[model samples]
Target: MNPLHRVGLATARHPWRTIAAWILVLVALGGLAATLGGELRDNWNVPDTRAQHGVDQLREHFPDAGGSSAQVVLHDDARLDAAVVDEVVAELEGSEHVTTVTPRLSEDGDTALLYVRYDVPTTDTDIYGIVDPLWEAAEPAEEAGYQVELGGELPGTATEIEGRGELIGILVALALLVIAFGSVVAAGLPIAVAVGGLVAGSSGVMLLAGLMDVSTSAPTIATMVGLGVGIDYALLIVTRHVARLRAGDTPVEAAARATATAGRSVVGAGLTVLVSLMGLRLAGLPTYDAFGFATAISVVCVMAAALTLVPALCALAGRRLMPRKVRRLDTSSPSGSDYSTTERGSSTTDDTWTARWVATVARKPVAWALVALTVLLALGAPALGMRTWPQDGGSDPKDSTTRAAYDLITDEFGPGANGPITLVADLDEVSPGEVEALHREVADLDEVASSTPVSTSPDGRLAVWDIEPTTSPIDEDTTVFLDELRADVLPDGVEATGYTPILGDISELLQERLWLVVGFVVLVSIVLLTVMFRSIVVPLKAAAMNLLSIAAAYGVLTLVFQHGWGSALLGVDHAIPVSSWVPILMFAVLFGLSMDYEVFLLSAVRDDWLDTGDAKGSVVRGIASTGRVISVAAAIMVAVFLGFATESAVVVKMLGVGLAVAVALDATVVRMILVPATMTLLGKWNWWLPGRSSAARQLDDELDVTPTPTH
Candidate 1:
C-alpha cells in the first residue's frame, strides 16, 4: 500500500486514538505558543535602497532623533492654545518608548505638531500604545475646541482582525457543507478537521515568530489561507469517503481508499502552494519571509490533518457521513473488494443533469474554449494598467485618527506636510554650509513647498532635515518628484528616505522583479506538474490556464481598487494604487489554488482515459465525476476569502477580494467549461508524456499507478 493509503488505514483503524492524539497535540502547541511565541510586529526590510541607507545613517549618528516617530496634531481653525499643546507634549514624553518630543508651530499659527520620537523602530513598537497616551492627553485640547488626532504610522497601522472574518467564513462553510452533503455529521467533520489543523498550524507559526520578524498581517493572512485550503482538503476527503462507503466498502476500508486518492490530491495541492510561495523568497523582503512561513506552515499542518484526521473522523462518523437515503451501507457487496472501480458513490448516466451539461460543453469544444478565453482575458485586461503603491494611512476612513490628521495637516500646513521627505547627511564628509546649499537648491524646485534648515547632531557629524512637497503623499506627482530629486540632485554622500521614496522604491523593485518571480514560479510549477501527471501538454496547459486565472484576479483588483470603480461599496471612497506587495502575493496564492482544480480534474480525466480508452468520453466523465466537488470547494474558498474582505486594512481587503474573484472564475469558467472543452479538443494528446508506460504512474510516483475508474 502507498504511504497515503497506509496513513489513512492506520488512522481509521484507531479512530479514537488518532482523535485523542490530535487533541493532545493541539493543546500542547497552543499552550507553548501562548506562553513563548514572539510578538507580531510590522517589519518591512527594504535593504540596500537609498531610503534604507539614509535611515541607517540617522540611526547611527542621531540616535535620539533617528528611530520611528509620530506626530500629535493639535489643530483648531479658530485660533491657538499654548497651554494645551504643552500639556500634550509633557504627556507624550512620559509614554513608554518615547525618546524626545519636539514641538513646532505651523506658519498659519492655527496648527501645532509635537514630533514624538520613540527609542524603538516603528516595526518593533506598539503604535496604539504610543497613541493611547496621545489620545488621552489630547482630551483637554478637544474640550477646548481643538481637533486632536494621531498622525503618521500610528493611526494608519493595520491591526489584526479579531477572528470575526474567520468565524463568519467557518459558519458559511458549515452551511455550505450541510447543503453539499445533506448530513450535519458529514458537514461538521470537515470543519472539525480543518479547525484542528488550523489550530496546530497557527501555533506552529506562533512558535516560528520567535526566530523571525513576523508581520502583523501574517496571522490574518495565514488564517485566511488555512481556513480556505484546510476546509477544502477535508471536504475532498469527506466526499471521497462517502462515495466509498456507498460503494459498499467498510468504513475503515473506505477511509483508507479516500485518503489514498483525495489525500494524495491534498498533498499535491499543498506542495504546489509551498513551491509557489518559495518564489516569494526571491522577492527578498523580510515581511514576505514571515508571510511565507506562516502560510506554508498552515498548508503543511492542515494537509497532515486532512490526511490523518479526516480518515479517523470518517471512521468515527461511519454510516452517518453518507446521505440520508444511502445511510444503510451494505459492506457485503462484491464490488467493495476493489477501491479503484468505486470512484464515486453513484453511477453516472447520460440522463443526469451534470452529465448532460458536460456533454453539451464537450460537443462544441472550440466555441466553449473561445468564450471562456475571451471572458478570462477581458477580466484580466485591466491588470496591464495597474498602479501599485505601498499601504498608506492617508487612505483610511475619515473617522480614523490617521486620516483626520492627514486632512488637518493638508488643510492647515499643505498637502506636503502629511508626508515630508527626510534628508540625512554625514556632516563630517560634507560641511554644514554645503548641506544648507543643497537644501536651498531643493527648496527652489517646483515640487518643493518648503525645506527645513538642517538640524545638526550634538557631535556635529550628522544633519537631518524635513522637506515638504506641494503634492499629497499618495499623489503620483510626489513619487515623480522624489525620483527626479534622487537621480538628478541628491549626491552620493547625501541620502533621502521618506514616505514617497520608500513607496517608489518598493513599487519599482516589485514591478521590476515581478517577471523573474513569474518565470521562476511558472517554470518550477510546470516541472512539478509534469512529474505528477506525466504529461508535458497537461502541465503546460494547466500553467497557461492558471496564469489566466491570476491575471483575471489582478484585473478585478485594478478595476475595483485602482480605478475606484465600485470601490465605495467596499469601504474605499476614492482611487488608490494597489498595494505594491499585493500583486506578487496574489500570483503566488492564486496560481497554486487554481492549479488545485486542475489537479483534481486531470486526475479524474486520466483515470477514465486509462479505463475506457475514449478521450472525449473520459473528459465528459471526469467533469461529471469531479465537477460538483470542485465547485463546492471553490465556493467554500470564495466565501472564506470574502469573509476576510470585511477587514478594515486595505491590503487585507484587496487580497480577500482578489482571491475570491479568481477562485470564483477558476472553479466555474476555467475548470468546468474551459478545461473540459480544451480536453475534448485535445483528445488523446492530453495524456501524452515521454518515458512512461501506458499504465498510470502512482500518485507522485508516489504518483497513483492504479486507475480509479468509475461506472
Candidate 2:
C-alpha cells in the first residue's frame, strides 16, 4: 500500500489512539507556544542598500538619531496653543520611553505640533504599552477645547481593528458545505478537521516565533491559508468516503479506499502548496520567509489531519455520515453500481450539468479555448502598468490618528516633509567646503522642496541633513528624488536613509529578484506536476494555465487598487500603488492554489484514461466526475479569502481580493472551460512520453525478449 493509504489504514484500525495523540499534541504545543513564544515584529530592512548602510552607521555611531519619532497634534484657539503645548510636553517627559518632545507652532498660531522621540523603534511592542500615557496626557488638552491627535507608527500600531473575517469566512464555508453535501455531519466533518488543524498550526507558528523573527502578519496569513486548504482537503476525502459507502463498502473499507484514492490527491495538492510557499525563501525578504514558513506549517498540519483524523472520523461515523437521500441514490441505481461509474457511462448529453457542458465544449473545443484565452489575456493586461511601493500613513484608515497626523503634516508642511530623506555624512573624511557643496547640490534637485542645513554630531565626526521632497512619501516622484540622491548628487561619504529611500531600495530589490523567484517556483511546480500527472504535456499545460490565472489576478489588483477603478466599493477612496510585496507573495499563493484545482481535475482524468483506453471518453468522464467538487472547493477558498478583504491593512486587502479573484477564475475559466477544450484538442497526445512507455519496457523485460518497437 502507498503511504497515504497506509496512514489511513493505521488510523482506522486504532482510531482512539490516533485521535488521542493528536489532541495531546495540540494541547502540549498550545501550552508551550503561549508560555515561551517570542514577540513578532515587522522587518523594515532592505539589505545591502544605501539606506541599510546608513542605518547601520547611525546605529553604531549615532544611536539617538535612529530612535523612532511620533507627532502629537494639538489644535486650539490662538491664545491657548503655546501654554497647552508646553503643559503636554511636560506631561509626556515623565515617561521613561519618551526621550524628547519638541514643539513647533503654525504661522497662524492655531496649531501646535509636538515631535515626540522615543528611545526604541516604533514597532517595539513595549512602545505600544507606553502609548497609554501619551493618550492620558492628551486628555487634558481635549477637555481644554483643543483637538489632540497622536499620529505616527506607534499610534497606528495601537489602532486595534477587530477582525471578524475568519469567523464570517467560516460561517460562509459552513453554509456552502451544507448545501453541497446535503448532510450536516458530512459538512461539519471538514470544518472540524479544519479547525483542529488550524488550532495546532497556529500554535506551531507561535512556537516558531520564539525561534526566529516572524512577522506580525504571519499568523493571519497562515490562518487564511490553513483554513482554506484544510477545509478543502477534508472535503475531498469526505466526499469520496461518502461515495464509497454509497457504493456498498462498509464504513471501514470505504474510509480506507477514500484515504487511499482521494487521500493521494490531497497529498499531491498539499505538497504543491508546500513547495510553492517554500519558494518564498528565494525572495530574500524576512517577511516573506516568515509568512511562508508559517503558512507551510498550517498546510502540513491540515494535510496530516485530512489523512489521519478525517478517516478516523469516517470509520467511527459509518453509513450515517451520508444523508438518507444520498444513500438511496447510491444503492437504488438501476445497475446497483456506484454512481461514480454509472455517471461515467451515461450519455454525453446527460442530465448532469457538468456532462452536458463538457459535451458542448467537445463539439467546438478550439472556439471555446480561444474565447477563454482572450478573456484571461484581456483581464491580465492591466498588470503591465502596475507600480509597487510601500504604503504610507495616507493608506491608513481615515479615522486613525496616523491618518489625521499625516493630513496635518501635509497641510502645515509640504507633502515631502512627511517623509524627508535623511542624509548622513562622515565629516572626519570630508571638509567644510564639501558639506556646503553637498547642500547646494541637493537644493538644486527639481524634486526637492527644501533641504535642512547640516548639523554636526556631538563628536564632530558625523553630520546629518534632512531633505524634503515635493511629493508624498510613496509617490513615484519620491523614488525619482531617491535615485538622484544615490546616483548623481550625494558625495562619496554620504548616504540616504528614510521611508522614501528605504522603500525605493526594497522596490528595486524586489524587481531585480522577481524573475529568479518566479523561475524557481515555476520550475518546481513543473517537476511536481510531471510526477503527479505522469505526463510532460500535462505539466506544461498546467503551468501555463496557472500563470494565466495569476496574471488575471494581478490585472484585477492593478485595475482596482492602482487605478482606483472600484476603490469606493472596497472602502478605499484613493488610488495607491500596490504594496511592493503583494505581487510576489500573491504569485506564490495563487500559483499554489491554482495547482490545487489542476491536481484534482487532472488526477481524475488520468484515472479515467487508465480505466478506459478511449481518450475522449476519459476527458469528459473525468471532468464530469470531479467538476462539482472542484467548483465547491474553489468557492470555499474564494469565500474564505474574500472575507479578509475586510482587513484594514492595504496589503491584506490586496491579498484578499487577488486570491479570491484568482481562485474564482481558475475554477471556472481555466478548469472548466480551458482545460477540457485544450485536452480535447491534444487527444491521446496528452499521455505521450519521450522514452518507451514504462509498461511496454516492463512487459518486454518480463518476456526475456528484445523486440524493436515502431511508432
* Top-TM-score structure, candidate number: 1
TM-score of 2: 0.94
Q: Which pairs, if any, clash in model 2?
A: none
> What is the C-alpha lDDT profile of model 1 across 1-711, one tens digit per residue?
678889999999999999999989999999999998878766765886888777777777776555667878898885577888888788888887789888878876888977777777777655533456667867778888887878886545534465667987999999999988989999999888888888898899989887888887887888898889999999988988887876677899889988988887888888888888778877767888888889999888888899999999899888898667765544435644554455432535421667777799898989999999999999999999998888676777656777778888787778887788998888767887888889889989999998887788777887788889999878889888888888899876888887667777888888887887799989999999888877899999999999998899999999999999888887887899899989888888888888778888788787777666798898887778887788789989999998888777778889999999999999878876888898889998887887766554433333446436332
TM-score of each: 0.94, 0.94
C-alpha positional error of residue 552 in candidate 1 after TM-score superposition, expressed in Å: 0.8
Q: Give the clash count for each candidate.
A: 9, 0
Show where candidate 1 strays beyond 4 Å: 106-109, 125-130, 143-145, 328-351, 428-431, 691-711
For 607-662, candidate 2 gives per-residue lDDT tens digits of 76665657887888888888777888889999999898888877888999999999
Candidate 2: where is the Cα deviation over 4 Å? 77-80, 128-130, 159-161, 327-351, 444-446, 693-711
